[model samples]
Target: MVLKNILHHRFFENFLKYRYLLTELVKRDIKVRYRRSVLGIFWSFLEPLLFMIVLTIIFSTLFSRSIENYPVFLLSGRLVFMYFSQSTNGAMRSIKMNSPILKKLYVPKYIYTIALTLSALVTFLLSLIVLVMVMLATGAPFTPYIALFIVPTVLLTVFNIGVGLILATINVFFRDMEHLYGVFLTLLMYSSAIFFPPDVIPVDFQWILTWNPVYAMISLTRDLFLYGQMFDTFTLIFATISAIASLVIGLVLFYKYQDKFILHV
Candidate 1:
């Protein structure tokens, strides 16, 4: 009975009640993102494709000997990092961005962060079409392992939501967080080995790649999609732990401080 009551608690009730609003918020975010753009949603398809082309052109001579089908390798890692970067950034700004509606309404504050992340997820999924096209064009073989790509994708999304919640909570208090996080993301992108291979890192620094959840996810996807193999046990275990820990920490902080958000925002 206690579990049942908890399951249907008013918190969950509010989510169900406001579910429609969440859907509208996600739609609005996507529409507003491309509002004045020429190609609008198609940019989702083109942006990653263009980025992959440029990176392949620039780095092909340097790393092509080490990485086979370099375009696929680069695109797989780039897409995962791009989603993490975009989703987390959007979620960080979500609370402040929707302050006007928040002040006048009683909707759950976390909804804004979730809507932003989901919108980014929608964009990321669309970009995968470009990944598929590149894979076929480059003659990267499709294997049954490709289906396992969903495992890392789901874990990465959970990790993003967790990190997004924490960032949103902090950003509410510190306006400078926006700029600071941009710098951190730049560092993170470099550390993720998106454009380079793990072997490029010195032997002493290999643990940086091993412990980095973002890189773990990227490497996992690359294993499935590019290399046609299952991800190693350590990467899977570490990524799972990282994702769950982030979510737990993010939830604890966000809920503990959420009531104070209106004062700061």
Candidate 2:
């Protein structure tokens, strides 16, 4: 297949052209995130910790028995929320943020964004360590099923890569996309089941929550970490399809418009 050959060559070519740059970009991103800071990487844990504590107080004291193990409940949402939010935001800004290099050098447009995605992955790994610790400390049961989260985690990574590609490419032309993405991501965060349980939502709204692709990731996370069980077959199939669709659309957009990107910027 001619398409397959092009992809094969493209993959090998980009692998050679951008791999080292990606590595460096990831390192720089990590350093910049913690540069001149006392907490350094420890600060990665702070957001969820603070959020979990506040939510625990509100849910346990204020709501009074809305859910058991409120910290665990919040952690489920927080983990996936942090990953999706950071990856998408980072990716959306990737191309424009690397304008200097983009203009002077010949590199794949997707690399700039992948660099950001990889950077976020590094931080995600670091934060996941704290997540595991918090889970153990909170007396949540750990089992082999916990490994199941890795599937959706990988799916979410691919999903972000696709999202980043589309946004980064559009941002090169529209420019306002950067600001727009921030607002959209904020809406996405609240709509995601991060702070609220889906069951508490109205029956009419419950399907929306379950049907939301992001909610699947968050709910699967809760299932694995909070309940230590895999979701039913339908949910997994739907999530995989959604993730793949996003990837196909994103790559198509990136390839279609990438040639004009340099001129746009």
Candidate 3:
């Protein structure tokens, strides 16, 4: 019955309109990120740059024998990991952050989720440019196969959207989700092989990393950058299912908790 209303609702019918609003919200988020800073958009350049420099120094000096070209290696994994993290982390607090809009507008509310995702996507593009520049300067292999990365890139977007949707809905009731997310995401970064090669992780625990969807997502990006071939098709398919499931759950939970947000927040 609830599904019937969702199907029949005018907002559902006019999804393109909602999607356009999401674009505007994304734009607002991008501008607000740099509002008063003297450096403005340049600040976005600092984070990934510093991260690459710090890690490059640490890995090159400490683990020189184990990993080669750690700068390029980590950059490949970190960029993809950063996108997934940014999308989910931004989305978790999206509902609360947009309180003014929620209070004033009787909009379908899912618009906020879409908006936050779009905002993260803006940064994702900006960061990718810097990543490409570093790759070319460092003499990382350039290949025609890099173009094929669009498939998994799109897949990652859907996967994150599903997970982000679910988390944002729950956050309305349990504000602690936001605080706890940092810890979860930190551990997630390690598990995704952003810092070290998967080989270094213990053999017994290797499946934990190999089976993880985040790991596969990172692997896809690495293949696009390092090798000129598609990778791990079975894992990719499984991850796609996981992503779709996440979205369905997130949407359902959001709709279920829609009434409680006004009371709780």
The model with the greatest lDDT is 1
Q: Write the per-residue lDDT of candidate 1 for residues 1-265, one digit (tens) a residue.
A: 9999987986688789888988998899999989999999999998889999999999988998899989999999999999999999999999998888778888888889988888888898898889999999999999999988779888998999999999999999999999999999999888889999889999998888888999999999999989998889999999999999998898789999999998889
| Cα lDDT computed for each candidate against the true fold | 0.91, 0.79, 0.80
Candidate that beats the other on lDDT, 1 or 2, i.e. the better one: 1
Best by TM-score: 1
> Which rank order by TM-score, best down to worst?
1, 2, 3
**Over 4 Å off, model 1:** 1-5
Q: Compared to the true structure, candidate 2 yields what TM-score?
A: 0.92
Q: Write the per-residue lDDT of candidate 2 for residues 87-167, one digit (tens) a residue.
A: 778888877778788899887778778878878877777777777888888888897898777788888888888888888
Q: How many clashing residue pairs are found in candidate 2?
A: 0
The TM-score, computed over Cα atoms with residue i paired to residue i, of candidate 1 is 0.97
- Scored against the true structure, residue 38 in model 1 reaches a CA lDDT of 97
Question: In lDDT terms, how accurate is model 2?
Answer: 0.79
Pitting candidate 1 against candidate 3, the one with the higher TM-score is 1
lDDT, candidate 3, 1-265, per-residue tens: 9999978887577676577777778888889888989889887677888899998877767666776567767877887788888888888888888887688777777778767776777777787777787788778877887887777778788888878888888888899998899999998887887878788889999988877888888888777776656676887787788778777888788878887787766
